[model samples]
Every structure is written in C-alpha cells, then in structure tokens.
Target: MAAVGIAVVLGLAALLPTAALPCGALQPDNTTASKLLGTWLYVAGAAQFPQHLLELLLIANGHLQVEPGAGEQELPVPQRVAVGDQCLTNNSTYFEIAVGNTTLVKHAKTHQTVGTLMNLSSEDVLLIQYQLQRERTYLGLYLYARNLNVSTERREELERYAKCLGLSEEIVYAPWKTELCQVRDIEKGNSPCREPAAVVTASPPPGTHRPGSAGN
Candidate 1:
C-alpha cells in the first residue's frame, strides 16, 4: 500500500508559468490560467467483463502515456488529456468523472467560457466552470484532474456498480486506445518488413547470391 501521493509528488509540474496564456486572452479571466500545466492523472487501467483486464492513459504535450492495471484485483485511477478549464468541445468516452487538485497537487489556473458550454457532443470536453442562469437551467462543466489510482478503485467499485446501474461488460469500444498505447501500437512492428515491396540489387559472389545479403 504505497501512498498514492507518491505518484502525485512525482507528477508535479516543475514548470509553473509565470504568466499563462497569450497576452491576448488576458483581462479578468486568467482564473483558469493556472489550470493549464501539470501532468494530468488518468485511468491507469480499466475492468471489462470477458476481457479480464484494463488500463488507464494520460495525454500531454502531444504524448499519450499509459499505466498498466493490477490484473483482476483492482483498476487504477482514471486520468486523461481533458484536464483544463478550456471547455473542451467534443469528445467521447465510455464514461466521465469530476475531481480536482488532489491531496497530492493543487489547481491554480482558471478560464472563461468562450462559447455555449452545454450541448457538448462527442467532441466536447466539459472542462469549464460555467456561469449559468439557475432558473433557466444549465450545467457548468469542469475538466477534472482525477486520481492516478482511479482505474484500480474504479474497477473494484464498478464490479458491483455495473449490476446496480444495469450495465453490462458488453460496452462497445470497450478497449478504447489510451493515448500512450495508441502511439506505441503504431510504433511497433514494420508493416511490410517481412517482405519488401520493391528490391533493387545486392552485391554478390559472381552469380550465387542473396537478395540484399551480398550473395544475392
């Protein structure tokens, strides 16, 4: 039972922006500015029936990183790319959660609502603290900073939750790509290395030779 805070301390953002955002968006809305930096925590792993495994991914600086799961024991925390107050518009996932600066770190940034905050579709990232007309009805969305250990706890909880929610492991796109894994998968294996599409010539001993091995 290593304290999860160890992960937080390691993930701390050493580079805190002296002044976040461009000179342009400055005014009174710099609140969300502090929310920008730091490596966001994401699902370390997930639990799906019949699959018997799960993982969580973190995305930052154009890099998608992943944390593996602890087998069927428990899923780790849920963490991901949508950890700003930018009101990310449009995206999809099996489910979403809302958490903030953990006992580990703090959120010092803030942002403003640039457009309609609601009606977020698959492409919408609900990461903004919205200003709404209460009577009129509105849901303020805030991009959350979740625990890195969420996947494990989530898996443990969901085992019983799925039954309560009337949910099944038969979720479509269950094994979605974590940002890191996606990058890794594309990087592995040469697609056509087993056989080259085109071959020119090779140095050989007179006539007996290998294709490119000098004996071609």
Candidate 2:
C-alpha cells in the first residue's frame, strides 16, 4: 500500500503543473481575420520555454512575419510565412488559434499546430499559443501589443495571464528599446523588412525585469 501511494503521488506531481494552468479567455466566434492585421510590439511574454522579444506583423490575406530582438541572443532570422487558409477554432477564445503554414514542422520531425488568439482577454493584447502531440500539449504563450512600452496596468494583466497559464518561471522581460525593436508600422504601408536603426539609449539593460515583464 505504501508503494502504491508513492507511485500515485509521483503521478500527481507530474500532472500538477499542467492541471494548474489557466485556459485563458476564449476567442469569440464573431472575431474575423481582418481584425488581426497590424504591427505588434513584443512588450511582455510568458511560457514554459525561454522568452524573448519578437516583433510581429500580421498582413491581411498575406504573410505573418516576426522579428526578434532584446533579452537573449539575436532572434533567429525573421520568420515569414503565409497564413493558412483556415484558422482552427473550438469556439473558446482560450484555445482558438491563428493557423500558420501547416506544412512546417519542428526540427522537420514532429508536426506542430501554430495558432494565434487575437484580442484575447484584452483588445490591446494578442496571444500566440502552440499545441503539439495532437493538440494535447500546450507549449507556450506570447503577449504582443501596438505600443512599444507597456503600461503598469497592462503589465499586471500579462502577469495575471501568465500566472493563470502556469508560465511564471519562463517569463522574461524584453525591454522596449527603439533600436532593438521593430518601430515600423506596416498598417500605414510601411515596409516590413526595414533594417533596424542602430540608436542607443539609457533604457534598462537586458535580462532585467521592466514594467513589461511584470517587474522582478
């Protein structure tokens, strides 16, 4: 009986992390694809995996590209891919996703489902969440916005979402430095691949929690 009890405890321990995670808000059915087009900044984010700055541009009926800067090593070359024809949805804002090229896979080995939740939880924020192992695994969550700098209330709101999703540990602040961010607005017909300027400022050093990372 003691041996069985120990085994049960171990099983529950492994499951606890996932069980405690929050489902986040649901995507309303009325939401449409046009609502997602814009130039979004990487102000704050949380995940079970490493977090960093990633600027995203959602082009209407075109491509969704990203530029990562700040916090860690320079981001992988900007990823640009055509949005899938259909975004898979389950009617809940929490699990809904903006589908991406379904042909791409991680390490070219495992099939992955990439999706984004637009205006989820708040209109000022967008979430990109991933699922693997046939949608049974929730990998990570990214929070992006139009403003380069995050307000205190908005930062707290991101923290709350991270906590709810059980990603507090992986949370890292990607300080908003104009030089290190994609300051262009594509919605205004700006170029998506403009080279970032090399301007320096007195912003907080990287790895330090800014108001955006929910603060240290």
Candidate 3:
C-alpha cells in the first residue's frame, strides 16, 4: 500500500505544470553555435513594443550572415535588408556569447543588445528573442530559416511561441516576392537599388522591429 501511494504521488507531481523557463535558458551548445555559422533569411517577427513591430513591418526582405568571430566567444553577423526602394547593409555588428545561449550584440562599440538563441521543432528554423533593456517584459521575437520561406506549420509554431512570450499576435512577415540583396552586391557596394552609406546603427529605422534592437 505504501509503494502504491508513492507511485500515485509521483504521477501527480509529473502531471502538474512545471514553471516555464525563460527562452534559451541552458539550450545553447556547440552544436547550436555551429548551426548558426551560415546565412539565414528573416521569416516573420513579433514584438511586445510597437516600435519594434514597426521595424519588422518595414523590411521587405532581409538576409543575415553569421561567421565565427575571435575564439568561441563571439559571432560576427552581417546583415542586409531591403527597405522601401533602398538597400541597407551593416557589417560591423557582432554577438558575444555571454553564458550559455545568451548573446550580447555590439555595434561600433556603442550599442549593446542582449538576446538568446532558441531552436524550434524544425531543424531549419531558429528563433531569437531580444530583451528590451535587459528586461523580458518588453522584447521581440524573430524567426529565421535556412530557406527563403517557412511552412504554415512553422508560422503557426511562431505564433504559439510569441503568445508564450507575451508578444503581440500580429506577426509581420517579410514578403516573399521582394528580391533579397545579394551578399556579393552588398559587399561590392554595387546593388542597383539606392544603397545607403553603411552606418553603425544596430537596428533599422523606426517602423519595424529587428533583432539586436534591445539597446535601441
């Protein structure tokens, strides 16, 4: 009778809801770092703040290239985005791996934004959450993929995750028809569209929210 009682208690404990952990807590590892070494396309994003949401809405399409930085502590990320009729490129930003999967992105040694990397159900999709001013209350969630677009299931998953994060249900999806700026063109400064002078700004202009905009 005592053993049966213990078993029932254990089963009840297992059935009880556990406290939800902050996103990316204890999830980053060497495998995740390796997976982030290549390029990823921005799929959709949501934010708790309106400024961040506006930033996401302005982006037609965006591409991010992640490269291993000095040692294992840093990852250099270059990004190019098509906003309106102009292409904006920023190559001076890098993320420093702060304990575990937490990252601190710095631009021109000025702005600093804290973020975390979380892997979703699909291997091709990655979710990044940027905390506002180091607080979780106001944050933005951006989803990236190895491919140009993700499936409806993946988008639904993002919506669920956003809800869990207390972000707005309205997600801004980058249009698929917009031509993404080529990395080579961006590097060569030869894109046909109006190319802006590379600036040290970590986040985009007000309107859509972007990753690494925590400090902004």
Candidate 4:
C-alpha cells in the first residue's frame, strides 16, 4: 500500500504542473491568448527553427491551438491565456502584455473576436506578430508579442497592446531577429538547400526547442 501511495504521489507531481497551469490567462485580454487558439509563425531567412516569430494570421473561434512541437510536451507549462483586450472573451487577465509602452485596454462592454493587430495589409489575412525588446528582454529569450490587425472597432485597443509591449506591426522589410541562425541543416549537419520563411524568430515558443531537435 505504501508503494502504491508513493507511485500515486509521483503521478500527481508530474501532472500537477499541467493541471495547475492556468488554462490560459484567468482574466480576459490581460495576458496572452488561449493555448487552444491558433498561432502563426515567421520563418527565418535561412532555415533555422528558433528564429521563427509570429506571423500575420489570426485563428478564429478557438478552432486551432498552440502546442509544443514534439510530443515531449513537458509539465509546468505556461498557462494558456484566454482573453484579449478587456471586452474580448478570449483575452486573459494574466500577464499584462505591453507593446511600445502602452497597455491595451479592454472595452467597457464589448467582445471582438479579431485578435491583436499585426499590421495593415490588403491581403485580408489576420496573423499574430511576435516581438522582443532589446532593452528589456534578455539576450537569449524574448517576450512574445501579438501583431494582429483586428479590423473591428477593437483595432485601437489591439494596437495599444502592441505598443505597450514595444511590439510593432510586422514591417514588410523588417524580419525577426534571434541568436540562432540557419547555418547547418540542424538535422543532418548539412546546409539548407532552400530558404525558409522570410520572417525570423523561434519555433515552438522560442527557447522551447532547438532547430533539428526532435522538438523542432
């Protein structure tokens, strides 16, 4: 019985992290988006994995979600956020994501499905943008930023959030930056034959996995 008890404790220990992790930001539009939400990534100029960033695509109605690359999905994961701005139901009240020195505000009474604004484009496409502040962020890690256009009245709020976090719209010419580069194939130790995505950031949440690793 004692042995069985120990095993059960261990099991819970392993699961506790995941269980305790907030499904997402407990509050709406406070922290990040829902883990169950869709996310777009920017590819590096070469072919690196860690150099990927958020793209300008938007996930609707919570159909898609963000999960670790490999099944290696570990415990103690960051709580997925559920809210955006104040009115958006999906927005979380967790970490206050700031862009450009402004904190996006939630509407007094409204819920806009469109997420953070990434940029202004005619493509009619919505994507989330990732960003980092050189002054605030560490040399290795970067704070994830959202860059969705949000075509509704919520556009201003979304942009405010972007500015608060020091994140800006994905510029056509500018690309994401990171410490890693797509030098070798990362897998076979060879060079990449073709170019990867134009934007450079990290994959599977930067620092989560390395390029070529089973996670990547």
Q: What does candidate 2's lDDT look like per residue over 48-151, in tens digits?
A: 43222111111111112233224111111122111122111110111222233111111111111233342354566555543322223334455566554556
lDDT of 4 by residue, 1-216 (tens): 000000011111111122222112122232233332333222211111222222111111111123332222211122111111110111111122333322221211221111122333322222332222222221111122224333444344334433444444332211333222222222233322222222112222211111222211
Give the per-residue lDDT digits (tens) of candidate 3, residues 48-95: 766667766777777777887777667877667776555555665566
- Evaluation by lDDT, superior candidate among 3 and 4: 3
- Shift of residue 161 alpha carbon in model 3, Å: 2.0
lDDT of each: 0.21, 0.31, 0.57, 0.22
Worst window of 10 by summed lDDT in candidate 4: 1-10
Tens-place lDDT digits, model 1, residues 1-216:
111101111112232232321112112122222333232322222122222121111112111111222331111221222211110111110111122211111111211121111111212122221122212322111222223233443344433333332334332112223232232332342111122221211100001111122111
Which model scores highest in lDDT?
A: 3
Give Cα distance to truth, residue 130, candidate 4, Å. Answer: 8.1
Clashes of 1: 47
Best by TM-score: 3
